[model samples]
Target: MHSMRLKDKIVVITGASSGIGAITAQMLSKRGAIPILIARSEDKLKETASGIQGRFGMYTCDVRDSARVEETFAEILHAYGRIDILLNNAGYGKFADFTEMPSEEFQDMMDVNYMGIVRCTKAVVPHMLERGSGQIVNVASMAGKIGSSRAVAYTASKHAVLGFTNALRQELRKSGVVISAVNPGPIATDFFKIADPTGTYVKNVAKMMMTPEHVSEQIIKTMEKSKEEMDLPGLAAFGIRLYGLFPRLADKLTYNVMNKK
Candidate 1:
């Protein structure tokens, strides 16, 4: 095992009931970090914490509710004194063509995916600034950098997250506060159940899907040492850079080849 740099760190994870959030909470606890798990389901939060071997906390919070988010963080800060790190991992996506997607669904994605991070980050920044140290990790998506068909809303929401994270990072450059974004390609999580109800997308890219545990490890790495961004599966990261260099060609490929998956 590597040195436990996260030992004793207080980590707050949102959308922590399942998927990458739940797994990362477990990994953080194993590293001796005190993970404060947040989700909309109190029962689910308890279930997630039940697997931990060490100290941890759970809060039932729907990040989509700004007032609830503020209250939750205040309660957490009061109990823990300070938050060493915040993992904004609570987000969901629904795959659909832009024209077919419901307006409410798009609003929900933006509320949870983009504004949720905004609410949580705002709640922690003042305290972290006062202490002169902290880390904020936003769980973005590969779609944020490279858009694809049938996921217009999700892609837009994630793009907003990356934009917010980048601007915040520059603003807090010398504030002893670290802001980073983690972008991962399709992961084998329940996300597909919602994002791809037809089962077509998952089936098409089953072999390429990464595991939640693998994604959690990358998040842990960010917590231990901050980086501007961490893109999983080195090959995918390369593809993103290549896309940037030649967007016209990339668009053709993204539409013709990648969108099918």
Candidate 2:
């Protein structure tokens, strides 16, 4: 299949206030795409919009709210005419023992990480299906592929994201719309502030953490390439595949690595 050009395409990004989403909006604007930034923080969203090079729009949205998402997308369609891409990147993480994690905290992760994608995707899909062309990129994580010691809730939520992406891809096989999942391990962003408040994870993986710019570039490339899935940092991708092939040995290796930290 021919690669899709991003130039002049209308791209809607969730969590556009900062990190990957914000960087992506800037990059996409530079590449000639109109980026519609969405997040809960109106001021931060505007800050992101202010940095973009071309015409762009910012909408303050909490993805967990289905009604608001619907209304936001309606406004987007009215302004832009059509959405060529949807990047679902609104999510957070809180690492804690499964038993110690509060029920509300766990639900919050599910709401934003998993259902946020569901709500946004549902809102935009019909338009894509009717038009018969579009791209949906879900920014998942390496945690989605391999379970870690201290992130039960976060891991489970990402796992669900992967499942949703895969299932949606299959269902849209004949449709022109493309579905992709990006799994990047430990990105250097404000996400760590909440995910690892003590900075233990950040400290442990400081050298390993990929920058938001790097991940955003990969995501944009994936949209053009129409890849079904991608893993950032080739070595981590290999490790994830290895874990799938040899679970017992991989488990032992993981345990040793965690123990060292």
Candidate 3:
């Protein structure tokens, strides 16, 4: 299939206040796409919009709030007439032992990481279906593909995201609405401050962290190419595939690698 051009495309990005979403909005704007930024921070959204060169819109809506998500999408549709792309990127993670973690924290992770994507996708998909041409990209994580120590809830939420994306893709196979997932490893962002408050995980994985710009670039390319999924960092992708084929052996190998100093 011929890749779609970015110029003049109406792109909606959730979690646009910071990290990958912010960088993606800037990049998309530079490529001549009209990026509509969404986040819970109205101030931060405005700040992001200020840096962009072309026309853009900012909406303050927490993705976990279905009513707010619906309203926000409705507003965007009223203003822009159509949505060409929807990037479901709003999510957070907490790294802790499952036994030590609180039930509330687990619920929060599921709400933001999994249901957030669900609400946003539900709101925007009908519009895409009506037009018969649109793109939906869910920002999942490598943890979704493989289990990791100290991230049970986080991993579970991401796993849910991957499953949801795959199922939706199959359901929309002939709907002209493309669906894809981007599974990135640790990113160099403030997310670590929230996920790993002690700074241990971030420091250990610092060397392997990819910049938000790098991930954003791949995501934009995926949007154009309509690739089914992407696992950032070639080594991580290899590990994930290996785990899929040989879970027992891969588990032992992963333990050894992760334990290496």
- List TM-score per model, in order: 0.98, 0.96, 0.96
lDDT of 1 by residue, 11-93 (tens): 99999999999999999988999999999999888889889999998999988888998999999999999999999999999
Candidate 1 wrong stretches, greater than 4 Å: none
Best by TM-score: 1
Angstrom error of the Cα, residue 162, model 1: value is 0.5
TM-score of 1: 0.98
lDDT of 3 by residue, 107-171 (tens): 99999999999999999899899999999999999889887777889989999999999999999
CA lDDT scores, all candidates in order: 0.92, 0.91, 0.90
**What does each candidate score in C-alpha RMSD?**
1.0, 2.2, 2.2
Per-candidate clashes, comma-separated: 0, 0, 0
**lDDT computed for candidate 3:** 0.90
lDDT of 1 at 119: 96
Window of ten residues with lowest summed lDDT in model 1:
252-261
Clashing pairs in 2: none
Poorest stretch of ten by lDDT in candidate 3: 252-261
